[model samples]
Structure formats: structure tokens, C-alpha cells
Target: MQTLNTLRSDARAIFDAALRAADPRLAVERVLARRGNHLLLNEIPIFDFTRGKLTVIGAGKAGAPMAQAVEAIVKPDDYLGAVNVKYGHLARHHAGVISNSARDGVRAPTKFILLYEAGHPLPDENTLRFTHSLLSLLEEQTENDLVLCLFSGGGSALMEYLVNGITLADLRVFTNELLRCGATIYEINTLRKHISQVKGGQIARLAQPARVVSLVLSDVLGSPLDVIASGPTAPDSSTFADCIAIVEKYHLRETFPPSIVAHYERGARGEIVETPKADDPLFARVTNVIIADNKIACDAAEREAQQRGYAVQVVSTTLQGEARELGHDIAARIKHAPTRTCVLGGGEPTVTIRGSGKGGRAQELTLAAAIEIEGDAELVVMSAGTDGTDGPTDAAGALADNTTVVRARALGMDAHTFLENNDAYHFFAALNDLIITGPTNTNVNDLMIALR
Candidate 1:
């Protein structure tokens, strides 16, 4: 039988292999190709570059690396595009990042392709500018032009152009309020679609007559195109009525900004046109291809686990609900599994903050598991975000085992108090158990592993 520490090492190695398998560069290189003079996406001819130019526009946490991969494939002179990525993505690379430079501020190879750093998990002033630049680029497109869009997680807050009368302040307030209120990505994006001039297939509308091919890296569970980054290119199935329901569901109708509420009110009343729907003729020229997802990541990890002689079972790919609660449940499952077995789960979970604590969902989940698995020295559990960030913390997530809680108590720390305050980062940091792989440039979702 494998020792507990050996199992922990194996689990982390499997998780890292999963991230490598989901790399955007490989994903793009697999799906996109230039055959002779024609551009093909997924073996289907998307454009005749002889008659039209190949243009690109995209936004997400992985936008920079995705764009870089496309740049390596396409004719440099033929491709002109811009991408909006999170702030720190452009400035740094850690040990895990493959880089030509040893220091920060590494320059990209694409001279014509522009990359802008924007906010994430929350929009900032630069977010509007990023979306506006993308919109302006689309306006320059012609019927013969082909639009290549790269999308991944973190695009929702990275690029946003709010509706008129909805100021940036209102957007910031609404986003902050809804984030802490425990609304799901679907619910939060429902509100965003109604308020944003750039999202909800509006990008497609603006790029009309131009064939749009979107290569998406799925972050949301099940790869629902309409929910990923608020589906800026894919047709939106949601309506203004849906936005109101989400607002009411979170009790943000009254507490949210006034102008924001009024915009939704007008949209609900049909004073403004709805986002493009499934039956809309505008979707005729658009194609959305999900090139990577959480299931793909999980499947890769499962292969790695089995190769190591562990009986592997993917518990769930659509794992959701409270972070702490899920940690407990997954720990219980590990205890029940056969000896030398690995349990895996992937999906973004929500955290309902009961106290003012500093931690991400992945950290909170690991800490909770630590407490639940107390005294069971044969088990190890770990959870991490694929993008190398969990919430706003520098570490991706945490790893804990049966003795984790006892270790904390020996150090005079209360694991329950830290978990309650949503402060798992500090707890794990003191334990020296944080999984710190900075900026993987790929995001499918969170992956959790338990070995018994």
C-alpha cells in the first residue's frame, strides 16, 4: 500500500498533468490549422484567406496564451487582433510558466496582435476600454473577413461595456454586491447580459456578415456556451425577464444601483430589445467550438491515477454548492472508497461568507476536508483551481490529510474558526501546504482529489 505522503504527491502530479493536457496552446494547435491558403477550424474550412483577412478578438484569463498560440499558427501579416486578459497575466511568469525571459515584462511575438491587461472577478476602468477596442476592431471587418475569437474563464469581468445610463460605478457596485451574495455564475451573468452592450452575442451582431469561429476553453460546468463569459459570441437564450428573476433571487433588486435596476426594469418591459436568441438569423454564420472543459481535465487525471495502480473514479464533474460542505462530503466518500483508490471531482463551487475571511473556494474546501478527515491518517485530499488562482489568493489551493486538524490544534490554531472566517489561506500557509503554481494560462475549473 502507498503511504499517505506518497499518495498526496501522486495526486498533485496527476492534477498537474491534467493542467498540461488542457493547455490552450495544445488545444488551439489541435483544432486550428492552415491548409495551403485556407484556414480550417476542426477540419472544417472556416475561411479563404486569399479573398479575406483573418482577424482575431478575444477575452479571458487565458486570452494571452491562447492568442500567442494562434499567432504561432497564422500568417503574421494576415492576422490582426486584440485580447483582454487579467492584470497580472501580462506582467509575470512563475516557475511553472514556460518563458524566454528570466524576469518580468516578457514581450509577446505577435506584433499586430494587441494584448491588454484588465480586471478579473471584478471589472475596473480598463475593462470598458478593453471591450470598446474589441468592438472597434469588429467594426473594421468586412463580409469576406473571418473573425477568430478565443474565450476561456475570467472573460466575464475582464471585458464589459455597460449599457447607457449605467455608469462604471454602478457596474462595480452591482458586481461587488452580487459576488458576496452567493449568486451562481448563471445568475450573475443573467444580470450582466442585460446590462452589457458588448456581451450576449452582441459581438456576433456587430461582426455581422463576417464568419465568426470561436474556440472556447470551457470553465463553466458542462461547457454551456451561453454562460461562459456571458456568451459574448454564442446566441443568448436568456431574456430580460430572466435578469429580473436573478436580481430578485439574490435580493439585489433594491440594494443594487438605482440606474442598474432601472435598466433591467426597462429591459423587462420590452423598452429595449432583447439579446439575440437561438432562432435568430444572426447565428447562421457563427460557430462555437468547446475545445477544453473540466471533464477533459478530470479524464486526464483519472488516466494518471490508474497508471499509478490506484482504482480511480470520477465522483462528479458538475460538482457545485457550498465549498465547506462539499469538502466534508468528499472526505466522507474517500473514507468509504476501497483501499488504494482515488476520488476526483471538478467544478467551480460557491462560497457563502459568514465572516470577513480571506480565502478562495479551493482553500476553504481543503480546510473543511482537513477538519472532517481528522484522525484518518490513511487519506489525503487536495483541491486547486486550474488557472493557478483560487479566489484572490496567490496559491492555487490547499492539500490536507487526516492529521491536518490535529497539527493545527497542536500549533494552537482553531481550524473551525479559520474556516468560519473564510480565511483558509492563512491556515494553509502556516501549515506550508499551499499548492502554489502561478498562472497556468489555462482554466477549465477547480479539480479536487481524495486518496484512500
Candidate 2:
């Protein structure tokens, strides 16, 4: 029988291997090659440029690699326009057009534009300006063109554009307030869709008459099209009423924008437009295909665990709720598991920020697990965002063993106090347990594994 320490180490190795296996670039290429250059969703090929010209207009953290894969398939003459991508993920050859500059591209058919490397988890002026240019590019499209939209996670922040009468400053304030208030990504995007010009199926509407094929890399729980990057190129099932209800539920009426308030009021009265629905005509010519999701990553992890001689059990692939509570629950389960047993879960978790301390969902989950796990059950827990970024911190997430609790206590660190202050980043950083991978160039929400 393997010792607890050995089991923990094995689980960590499996988790890391799983993440690498689910790389966005690799997934895009594999899925593309498997389905061929033209992907079909619901018997509709996403792109049929045999007659008209093909163009690419997309925005997301994984947009660069996705573009590279598409470029490999399409003819040079058939490829038109640009795809906005997160900084540092651009291919070497395509890096010439955009070089991490904050300026937007004006040139038509621009191949590579870095646009800006604004802060993550929050949008900035650069994010707004670049997004405006992206929308402008869509407006340039004619009915003879077909738009290949490469959408992935982090697009919501990368493509921030406020509706008329709303200021970016207001958005920033509202966004910061929501983060500090510990709102879920779903709630945050609902509010954002209500205030944005290009979110919640508006992009699909803008590209009307011109066909759109959205190649999506899902990063949200359940892989809902409407929640991934606020579903810019997909129809929205949520409404302004849903947005208003979320704000009121969170008691954010005081901080809510007056213009936003008016927009919702007008929308409620049918004076303003609502987002396109499932049966809307705008999506008649549009198709969205999910190229990758959390289940793929979890399956990879399970395979690695089984290969390593561990009995692997996938607890759930759509886990949700408070990170800390989930962490404790996982720890408790692992404590009773027999040796060489691995439990896995994948999904996004919410954080209700009561602490002023800096920490992400993954960090908080690891800290909570550390406190609940004890003895030489050798219980090991690992949780991380598939994108290699967790919150505002550079660390992907954190890993912990039984000794983590004692180690923190020896340093005068109180787990409950640290958690209360929302300071998991500092606490985990001190112990050198932070999993820093910079940008893995993929986003599929979060993954967790416990080995016992």
C-alpha cells in the first residue's frame, strides 16, 4: 500500500498532467482535425466559404491559438480580418501586427493584434478602446462575408464596451464592488450584459445577414453558451429583469448605475430591446460549437490517476457553490477514503468576500481543506483554474498536505483569520505552495482532486 505522502504527490502529478493535456491550442487543433476544417453543429457547417469570402473576428484569451489553428485550415486568400487575443499568447509569426501595444488596429484584415495587456479580473480603459475597435471591425463586414468567431474565456473582460449613457468609470466601480462583494461569474456577467454594447447576443445581432460560426472553448460551469464570455456571439436566455433581480438580491441598488437603472426600467416596459432568445431569427444563420470543456480536463485527470495505479472516482464535473465549504467537504471525504483512492471534481466555485485579504477561489478552497484535513491520512488536495490564473494573483492555485496547517500555525498564521480577511494568496505564497503557471492559454473554469 502506498503511503499518504506518496498518494498525495501522485494526485498532484496527475492533476498537473491533466491540465497540460487539455491545452486550448492542442484541443483546437485536435477538434478541428477530427471534424475537419469545417465544423458542423446541428447539421450546419460553421463555415462554408466555397462561395463567399471567409473572415475571422474574435476576442478572448485563447483567441490567438484558435486563430492559428483556423489559419492552418483556411486558404490565405479566404482568410480576412483580425482576431483580438490576450497578450503573450500570440504566435511568433503573427506577433508582428500587434506587439502588446495599448492601441487598437485600424488596418483592414489585420492578422495579429495584441490590442492591450490590461489587468485581469477587471477591465480598464485599454480594454474598452480595443473592444470598440473590435466592434468596428464587425461593422465593416458585408453580407458577402462569413465571420469565424473564436470565443473563449476571459473575453468578457477583454471586450468590455459600455452601452450609451454609461461611463467606463461606472463600470469599473460596479465591477470592483461586485468582486469585493463575492459575486459569482454568472451574476457578474448578467450585470455586464445589461450594461454592455457587445454582450448578450448583441454581437450576433450586429453580424446579422452575415453568417457567423462561433468556435467556443467553454470556461463556465455547465458550459452554458449565454454565460461564457457573456455569450457575445450567442443568444441570451437571461433578460434585463434577471440583471435587475440579481442586483437587488445582492443589495447593490445603491451602487447600481442610474443609466443601467433606466435601461432596465425601459426594457421592463418593452420600450427597449431585449437580448435574442433561443428561437430568435438572428441565430438562424449562426452556429456555436463547444470545442472543449471541463469534462475533457477531468477525464484526462482520471486517466492519469488510473494509469498511476490509483482508484479514481470523478465526484462531479459541474460542482458549484462556496469554495471553502466545498473544500471542507472534499477533505472530509478524502479522510475516510482507503489508500490510493483519488477523488476528482471540476467546475467553478463562488467566493463571498467578507475579508479584505487578497485570495482567489482556488486559494480559498486549498486553505479551507488544509484546516479540515489532519493526521497522516496523507490527504492531499489540489484546486486550480484551468487558465493558470486565479483571481488577481499570479498563482494558478494552491496545494496542501496535512503539514500545511501546522506550518501556518508555526508562522503565527491563523487559517480562520486568513480566510476571514480573504488573504489566501499571502498565506499560500509564504508556504511556497502556490501553483504559478502564468497563462496556460486555456480557460475551463476550475479543477480539484483529493488523494487519500
Predictions in order: lDDT: 0.86, 0.77
lDDT of 1 by residue, 1-452 (tens): 57878988998998998998888888899899877878888887888878997778888988877887787778556567888888667524323544332222224534566777777777887788767877788876778999999998998998898888988889889988877888888888888888987789988898988989999999998889999989988889898888888888878877899998888889889999999998889899999999899998999999999998889978899999999999999999998889988999999999987788789999999999999889975899999999999987899999999888888898999999999899999999989999999888889999999998
- TM-scores vs. true structure, each candidate: 0.95, 0.91
At residue 290, what lDDT does model 1 achieve? 93
lDDT of 1: 0.86
lDDT of model 2 at position 337: 88
lDDT digits (tens) for residues 147-247 of candidate 2: 77888898887777787788877777777778766677788888888878788988888877788878899898888898898898888888888877887
Residue 162, model 2: lDDT of 80
Clashing residue pairs, candidate 2? Answer: 357-421, 357-422
